[model samples]
Target: MATSGPVLLVSQAQQRKSRTYTPSPWGDFFLHHVPCTPSQLLSMKERAKVKEQQVRQIIHETIASSDLLHVFEKFRDESGAIVSGDDASCLLMLHDAAHARTHGEEILDGIVAWSKSRLQSLVVQKNLLEPELAEEVRCALETPRFRRVKRVEARRYIPVYEKKSTRDETILEFAKLDYNISQAIYCDELKELTIMVELHFWMLGVIHDPYCSRIMIVKIFVFISLFDDLMDNYSTTEESNVFTAAMERWDEQMAQQLPAGLKALLVRIFNATNKIEEELKLQGNMHAELIKKMVINSAKFYHAEVKWRDEHFVPTSLEEHLQKSIPTSACMQMANLALVSLGNVTTREDVEWVFTFPKIIRGACIVGRIANDIVSHEREQASSDHVASTVQTCMKQYNVTIKEANEKLRAVIEEAWMDIVQDSLEQERPRALLDIAINVARVADFMYKREDAYTLSFVIKDIIASMYIYSV
Candidate 1:
């Protein structure tokens, strides 16, 4: 049968509408609309570039004004050194804007090439400062520089926590994952990834505050992610296979190719996750521990559920098993991490009090992600005899379907956000940039399909927010 003109027009209109409404993390971070195809995306790049130029022109014109020049000098002493890295990065942003505007579709690719050179140069220049430090950095760089960069020689895993790599395989994996999930997601584009790394430098520049230099912040993210994965196994369904593939790609192949530093950094992330688990178990946070334990347990449940379905071994109803599996411990486990992350509030009571807020956020994340997975695999779910949190089962229990769950999840997330605001205000914390960044991550997470995004953001934001508020 031949397709009609009206159908084609309608299809085009829907596609356009979808692009506009997509909750993309990259779009949110860059403050632009999500792109649908390579061609459309190239067009968006040109548009972004043009806008960047306009921004640069405004900044240049402002700097040229006498008042601004005077203020810049006044802010510095007589033997004033050059502007700091923070300022340099800001200037780079302006430059990026101009390039984006001027270069059109070439802006992203050009910027990426430029950044790789810049990173290499930065490493070379650092070598000039101290040969020993530079050599150590180079060695580590040969390891795991994707999520982290090389730091001074420390035999023990020093949690380097940078950002992901920008290689083809990594990009392709992220793109495929995002597409398969049918949700707005963010992957580390070359520019964004560079900016994320530069952010570490920016913090060190503006506030040579020792805490800013500590390993605590990076470790927190790693721990929170592991904890989230443990607790939210149900939300994963078929989507887990995609992530598993990505991990396998990293371990089997990508790990072999990265700089020594990057490879070590990836190894450190896993070590850190295990360490956190040990510490939590020692502290007797049973709820959190159980979540980790249950990933393996849930798999067993699926196996048993399948056997029951096949042989009709009616030991207990599937509903009973499901209910038993979802322990009330999740709320408490989430609360523990949230309080710990909020730097200023460390005691048991402080953590206990904040537990309520984390629970709400956890629920939102689980429900939102689980619903998304079901929607994406609606047909697969129909065919599977036994699957965790499938749409059919979800509808049976809640009297609502996937879309309804997403809406409800959104409302829950909003409510928990207010609690976060209230907690910060009550604690009288200073809303530092780190805290704000954590909150931004939390908000940006809604644009992604990762179940961990919500849980990680909650812990990150709560911790940073509490640090500002509690002053500990």
Candidate 2:
């Protein structure tokens, strides 16, 4: 196949200076410069260049060719291992092909399966390879680029590509510069958002990964944080009701008669949702329309809580409290957004399953709602106007002490988690989908385990700095 990109060249001076020697614990290793003919050195350099060129050709062919089977046939030798001799490059191609949206007619499926098996075998025997090559193999095996954390992958890949003589210097330089630029953008977005409403963007590193899916999830959480703040601190019962109705209508006319802050928030939500829908469409997800309904339902649930607070009506029963609070938790909406982030792996059936409010989804939301109540009820009670949390409702209905109510709520949280575990085992749920729901509960636990970490900026500053500010 004809390659489109310009060929890269490595200078002899640069190649000569690239060798390194490390002394062994045994002693003075004059072995570092074991006598070699100048011709031998030149031959080694040429062989390295040939291997690099082959690897780059494989990458280019995989990317440029529409017929994956033809590309696979050309790249693989009789034994079926990719002919590149660069395992990392082959692994990258396998990942890209596996993730391609070809519906059920995946031409690269056999290649992916073969590549995975071959890679696993190489990883097991990695001790036989050079230190750098061994590490590369280990990293690829540990987390394929498709699944690797985005920021970590950038940090890891830049040096690998830099060492490849066949890689265009301009491309390597661009990757380095892009990493710095992306980090700056993430920091700026997080800093402004943290000030407005406390949240830890630990997942920001995901921006470097596939389709910007991780950052999209972060964006959804940012909006969730802002919406929570507006509901908890700013809007009155009447104002919140009006805003909720407008959200349900989801039209420009609904923005009329709203306060400036609520109006601005509505616009942001609309724009964000529109952007998310566009991304979903590009990924070929047919259920993109469901995302808007999920968000609207979340808003309506928020309004229900506001109504209860406004009427000074605590639920008379635990069931009533759960029924009201679970949807309002917004975990389901977040879970659905998480599904959307999976791109081609998520089917319309997956979206429909989520909409059904299965055991796992319900369990996760219940855990989140009750966990928040457990940690934040005291602070929330200090506020003159506050919706009754699960803790308060349990305390009032059972005529129990605060400690007892908390204990009961904790048990409920435990039961909900069991429900998740049971559903995961029985239904053969998609691991990715299950993971998102599990993460929703995990985030809830992290935010509310000791206190409302999401509401308290200082509590998670160290975490933010370590994940985003400090390099790995």
lDDT for 376 (candidate 1): 42
lDDT of each: 0.35, 0.63
Q: Which ten residues in a row have the lowest lDDT in candidate 2?
A: 12-21
Structure candidate 2, residue pairs in collision? none
- Tens-place lDDT digits, model 2, residues 1-472: 2442222112211211111222222122221212334565355455545555655776787689766456546766787654545455566566444532222423455555566676667666736566666676666554444434345456667877778777876456545545544544454444434432223243442123333435556666666655555665667555676788888888856777676877888888999888987887887877677777877776777777766665667888888988888887777877777677666577878877987789989987887799888887987777655778888889988999999999998878756766765676667767777767766665665566677666555675565544445433
Say which candidate scores most in lDDT: 2
C-alpha RMSD of each candidate structure in angstroms: 23.7, 21.4
Flag regions of model 2 displaced more than 4 Å: 1-212
Across 332-432, the per-residue lDDT of candidate 1 in tens digits comes to 23223433434443444444433333433333334333434434445334433323443344445566766775555444343433443334444533444
